[model samples]
Target: MSGRVSHTVDMSVKLGELTLRTPVLTASGTFASGREFADFIDLERLGAVVTKGVSLEPWEGSPSPRIAETPSGMLNSIGLQNPGVEAFCEDDLAWLSSVDVPVIVNVSGHTVLEYVSVIERLEVEPRVDAYEINISCPNVDSGGMAFGTACTPAEEVTRACRAATSRPLIVKLSPNVTDIAEIARAVVASGADGVSLINTLLGMAIDIRTFRPKLARIVGGLSGPAIKPVALRMVWQVAGAVDVPVIGMGGITDTEDAVEFMLAGATAISVGTANFVDPTTVMRVTDGLAEFCRTRSIARVSNLTGAMRT
Candidate 1:
């Protein structure tokens, strides 16, 4: 174990031979709030950026008062509110071009045809580095539960999208599944190059006095430090079950948390909820990892990935 640990990793690891500079990336949705913070963190600094989930049609999203704070984490039902793909490309793609990072476009759809149509439009575009299909979005009531979090449509959705795009395809799995490893293996078998796990866990909160739901939507995806353990466990199981790389997320607030996931077998780590707490987390964590390797004389951060053994 120490022998492998001492070997330098070069900060570049292959996800089926496609190399990434660093394993630290901003989780989709968290890093997808337009380009306001793009200037704060050099977009080029990230391994890859998966934008927020964009729908075919502009969705008003869930009712207002969409968030609530939990002890170790926060609950949100932001819905996949976006300006639609056409608007996103027109206005947002410009900033994307300004950034030198690989933009992994995230697509959300209610049905098979819807998914195909969106990808088809993006397929012709130039700035996209990859596609992260979010199958476990629990906010919207309609297609929110449609594409994923279940076995039936999970494999079907992955197979359909794989046939549609020639670029690298990553299926974002939902922790809501009964046995997440089952779905992870299925995604790899269905032609997905990699998988991102534990898309927010499904949860709810209730107001004490009114005896009503705390949030207007009544339910939302739970994220933050609270879900870290769950995310780590799922990533561990899935990484062992599948051949493809695993991008781990959930309550990752710092470099240590990111290291935990890597040790658990995650090829990459995404900073999600932590972004809300501190917007500069992307650069902070990335720099911290670099420092970590430098101080420890560990040469490459990728060497930390999957360092655990049974």
Candidate 2:
């Protein structure tokens, strides 16, 4: 009975040439290279592990009190803190190579050359299966949201990175843009194989008693359930605009949320803040996707993409 049920639905998804065993991926900056959550959930079960933002050099990041909890979500200004690309390969990549799942490195840099350099360095590493260019990070003072918010810069960065490596390139998009679909088109036209969004909305909070900003950065990126509606809208719009693939993420907390993204035309979905709430959120959503399809008699989960009725 179990064997028959398992074969009833196909959960595999393709993002460009990279094939994921399932459509569920962990959002960058949340899973921390998959090692921390390995004990809580099986790393092999994940469709792919997206590591935290890794720059060409180590980033000191923002000062303390960079995180704040709000009504239905949280704000953080981590500024893409990491041990740099070289150290990351020697340590995180080396360990991740042994795991059975695919590793998608999140590349970060202050310049277009820096982003290209990071990819060039990882090209020789056999463990890296793909690259997620994080041009949409809002916390950093420079190069984060700067490259992603506009078409010219977004295209320039995507074009440079595209020339750097043949590995699957997925550009992470910022929701702060005036028109996210335009940015998506810019990246895709510049040779991006896929695009992931909506990287936290620009948000802020104030400590009423102290009469000071809640976060040291004053304005940080807001994530979690608060942004779900906006995220879904952008995902739908981008998916309709782009021909490659759309990896949707933002406030996804459960199986139904994942389904909503797929129906909105997301080729794959990533779990961000939910991982902090429950380490097993990805696994649960992954399993739930299969069950969701099985019960609906949908032979493949891919069929769910863009299935929403007009």
Candidate 3:
């Protein structure tokens, strides 16, 4: 009975050489591993699970008031706060391995060496199927601006990490740049297997009563529906610039947003802030995508990638 329903539309997508049975994946940091959403969603239903940013050493994250709610979105300076790669390999990876899904580790660092160190360690881990190089974390070593804003450093980091791991490398891009397409091409040239775009635009909030910044860091990554338009534009531009697979993310909350991204040239999509509002958002988007295709008489969801004429 279920086989007949699934055959109606092909939801599979390929990120570089890695194929995913579905096009929807969880945005790193937003979904955690599977512990938080495990009760709300079936891990096996997702195309892949992108774990939070893991570094060479444990990070305490930022100070108090790291999160601040905004209009239609939120700002977070939680930093790359993680239990380090070694600890993650022992704890998180164990929980992830038990689930029937591919794991894409989101790697972060203070320098190219830091990124390489984590990648080198995970290279031997059988549970790691792919890597999502988080060059977009805002509360990190250089406030996330040092590495992701320019083409040179982005390429340098991508090149170093590419050489350190055999697994697929997906460079997550920051929108806090002049030309995102330029950065996209730079990373792909440096050997990025794929690219994830529009990772939280740098933003800030002010408290009227205190006459001070809402967040302690003053500036943080902004994500939610508010950035969807910006994210879509960037995805479209980057998708046209790079030949490698482009994974789109930024304000994806519903199937409509996911479909829009695919039409903009996203080979795959990731659900982020929306997860906090609805734990089962990913599952809803997945099922919604299938129903959309069936109603439109579309045969495969992959066909939606870059389907826009202009």
Cα lDDT tens digits, model 2, 1-310, are 1232367798899998988989999999999999999898888878899999999999989997999999889999999889999999999998998899999999999999999999999999999999999999999888989999999999999999999999999999999988999999999999999999989999999999999999999999999999999999999999999999899999999999999999999999999999999998998888888888998899999999999999
lDDT of each: 0.82, 0.93, 0.90
Shift in Å, residue 181, candidate 1: 0.2
201-275 per-residue lDDT for model 3 (tens digits): 889999999999999989899999999999999999999998999999999999999999999999999999999
* Number of the predicted model whose lDDT against the real structure is largest: 2
- Candidate 1 stretches greater than 4 Å from native: 1-9
Scored by TM-score, the top model is: 2
* Residue pairs with backbone overlap in model 3: none
lDDT tens readout by residue for model 1, 1-310: 1222223545555555457767877888887743867667666667877788877778777897889899899999989888888888887776787767777888898787777778888888888778888888998765655667676688898899889988889899988878999888887888899999889988999989999887898989899999999999999999889888899999999988888899899988889999888888877777667767767887777778888877
Task: In model 1, state the lDDT of residue 16.
Answer: 57
Clashing pairs in 2: none
Q: Clash number for every model?
A: 1, 0, 0
Candidate 2's TM-score reads 0.98
